[model samples]
Target: MTAKVLNIIKILQPVVIMVVVQISLAGVNILSKLASIDGMSSSILVAYRLLFAAASTVPLAFYMDRTIKPRPMLTWTVIGQAFLCGLLGGSLLLNMYMQSLVLTSVTFVAAMSNLLPVITFILAICFRLEKVLLTKAPGSMKIVGTILGIGGAMLMTFYKGIEIKLWSTNIQLYAHESTSTNKQDRVLGTLIALGSCLSFATWLIVQAKLSKIYPNPYSTTAMMNVMGSLQAILFALFADHDWQHWKLGWDIRLVTVSVSGMIGSGLMVALMAWCNRTKGPLFVSIFSPVCLVVVTLVGTLILGDKLYLGSVLGSIVIVLGLYAVVWAKSKEKESIQCIEEKEQGIV
Candidate 1:
């Protein structure tokens, strides 16, 4: 293949991988809901997931990254990454999100997730990982996209308009009763979910830094998972002293831990780190809003969820906003590359 073809493939590969990551995340959301049905604490579930994730990734880290000698400060940097990503982002964020799912509709949980990219973009700018070139069209598009995405998410959260019934006879609308329909509970859940988004955004910033310092995806993931597992287990032990909550069997809980550990944390974290290294946190994070759409489809088709008008409308807006942001970033990158080439030619 020509260099141009290879370059195009390289640029597009992360986008495709990020989409797969979102789909896997959507599956994790549905499976987590299913697993939680048995009355498992979110903290406990997270603990097990982290443990499994650590076990699964450690071998790969040792095998793949063994040849590279680590800098002394790299350990400290990795620890920081662990605390930011594993404990706060992975364990705490997920636990809070799961709790929110318990209180609100799955659609609400998914919709709220669209706020991630907006949060990450803001954090990225604060950290100097992203630029706000207001003079440029790309910058304007990004700023506008951020506003639209956040606005759409807020609209979805507050508004539950008329239901939109689709024409598929097989897609029956099965309205599952929310655990707490009280307005207060929903509000609380929304707040918690928003908190999760903030933590996750913080993780993206930290991961971007780590990618530069460590530059080892598998080892970084394993270290983070190990630290997260320990932290989660300690929290779970303190919060839920009951031995029964810690019990594991050949059931959905097992499936949840296994799949979540292997695919969700192990695979997803590695992919995210690689993407962050190659594309930057904003590029990786912008794909998060897509999960809302994926989850809506999954909920409607597989889980027999009723499609609501507000959700559909808000999701459409969110998607449009996401596209705008991605387009802006793409154009900005291309423009920068072109300038570099021109400079090289002049030299």
Candidate 2:
């Protein structure tokens, strides 16, 4: 019975955990909308998210790592990496995402997230985190998929107003949306959104490397949330100057804070780390498209947003690109196995 249970758990773990991560993230979006109504500053909101996240995870990490002794360097490395992930990726990226959602429509926001895998692949190759072997189908497909993903993002962004002239991609959708946002705000939001993507993409690579070294994703995540929560709170206190209320009492504010922090930030990060460890960052990157799909459907059906053909086409391209990259990975693995087998036979 015990063996059967273990087998079932091992089989279901990835599916169950990925679903949890997706749900937690979706929940965060709802809470962010609610939190905005309370006039919570973005820093304060994210800080609260981190704080409750840390509080929940600390005990779990301690319990899991109680019997396992790790090298100081390893522990510190994971901690430092987690800090970077939280500070730049968690705090800054999230701040941009929240700010961008306010500036652009939800459609644009979701569209931008779909670029994550493409961005990660580019950054990984550029930074030499991932080797790009031109000879291999995997490398070629990764590059092609990256191009398709970026093209899809552009298509969604410009949509019906797409303007084409020689030597430039003159997108007309920007002009239309520019009407929705005044020049100054448009500039600010665009910068913020792009910055968010940069931070997020960089962090994905960082987490991938960190997962390789520190197998304990849970511990790494718990520590980062602890640090991030404190940093965000400090910023909130000075920037917004109203931490006293939530600090003073337990209310819905406190409840949301606790839930978003622990379950959303803490648990999600741990899941990401675990996914990165077991499946590789390549596999985790595919989740970007999954999130985009889920968010889009929800927004359209629930929020009554209009769907566009370009967006539809872009989503299909993204799905296809995801499959291409995954298939390429399998081919590469098979080739590697063949090489190893040949070497063993000769030896």
Candidate 3:
């Protein structure tokens, strides 16, 4: 029974990792909502999250590896690179994500999030980290999937302008209140999201190399958290943020920050690395839309937000596109395995 359970767990790792990612995101939203009530600035909130994650994780990493002296030289540089990636991706976009929640519809934000894979794909191509041979079905599917997903995201964003109905002026009919607000929010939010994609792509590129050099996920995560903690602190200080305005009266503050720090940053990062190893980066990313769907439900029902027709339709298109890409990859992988089996049989 024990052996059978262990085998089952081995098979279930990918599902488990995806669940971790989804729960982590849901936790982030819960925390964001709670933290906002405290009137905490986005930067400060990000700092606190990083601080808590770093504080908690450092000990775990040390305790796990007590037998071996921590190799500073081997992991520090990789950690620093991850830090820079997080600084660009996490620090910039986390603030943007916070700002977006105040201005945009959760559905719109989530739908647009589908663009991360496309953005990452493009960056991967540019960085020469990913290559697709047009003739290869899998590669073609990946490229097509990236395009479809991005196209769907764009449709979701731009479709509002296509209809100038009474609801268009209804302020809450769409995601953001006004065009100017939407534009400003999207301009910053999308940019931040794109930066997030870049950081993520950087992880795909850098971590692949790091894993080749050193395969310790715990150490890698802990050291990167340390650097992220430092960078977040510095950014907060340099931003001239005045903490006097902090009003922690709300009972939800601690709960939210606790969820965000522990689940979002802490557990998710560790699971992400594990998932990437087991499921391939693209495979791990395919399920992100699932989280968006959850967020949309919470946003519309609990938050009392209106869902526009175009936003709904566009989201569907984006999901279809995302699935199409994944399907293509799956088909391609099966074909490769078949040929490998044939070769083994011939031998």
Model 1 over residues 49-132: C-alpha lDDT tens digits?
A: 989999999998888888877533567656877677786657787788888987776677887777777777777788797898
Error of 1 at 99 (Å): 1.6
Alpha-carbon deviation at 214 in model 3, angstroms: 3.0
TM-score of each: 0.87, 0.79, 0.81
- TM-score quality measure for candidate 1: 0.87
lDDT of 3 by residue, 1-347 (tens): 69999999888878877866875686587457545544567777777777777777678777866676555456576656666645653565566666665456455666766665666667778879666778977788887777777777666655654432222222222233222235666556555555555566666656555545556666666766677778877887777457664334545665665667666767677677667665676777777787787876665554545566667777777777777766866787797789999989953
Error of 3 at 124 (Å): 2.2
| Superposition error at 182 for model 1 (Å) | 3.3
Give the best candidate by TM-score: 1
The residue-by-residue lDDT of candidate 2 on 9-38, one tens digit each, is 997888777776765676666556445545
Candidate 3 minimal-lDDT segment of 10 residues: 164-173
Q: Distance from true position, residue 219, model 2, in Å?
A: 1.5
- Residue 111, model 1: Cα distance from true site in angstroms: 2.6
By TM-score, highest first, what's the ranking? Answer: 1, 3, 2
Cα deviation of 91 in candidate 3 (Å)?
A: 2.6
Name the candidate that leads on lDDT.
Answer: 1
Local distance difference test values of all predictions, in order: 0.80, 0.67, 0.65
List residue ranges in candidate 3 displaced over 4 A: 2-6, 67-76, 161-184, 246-250, 332-347
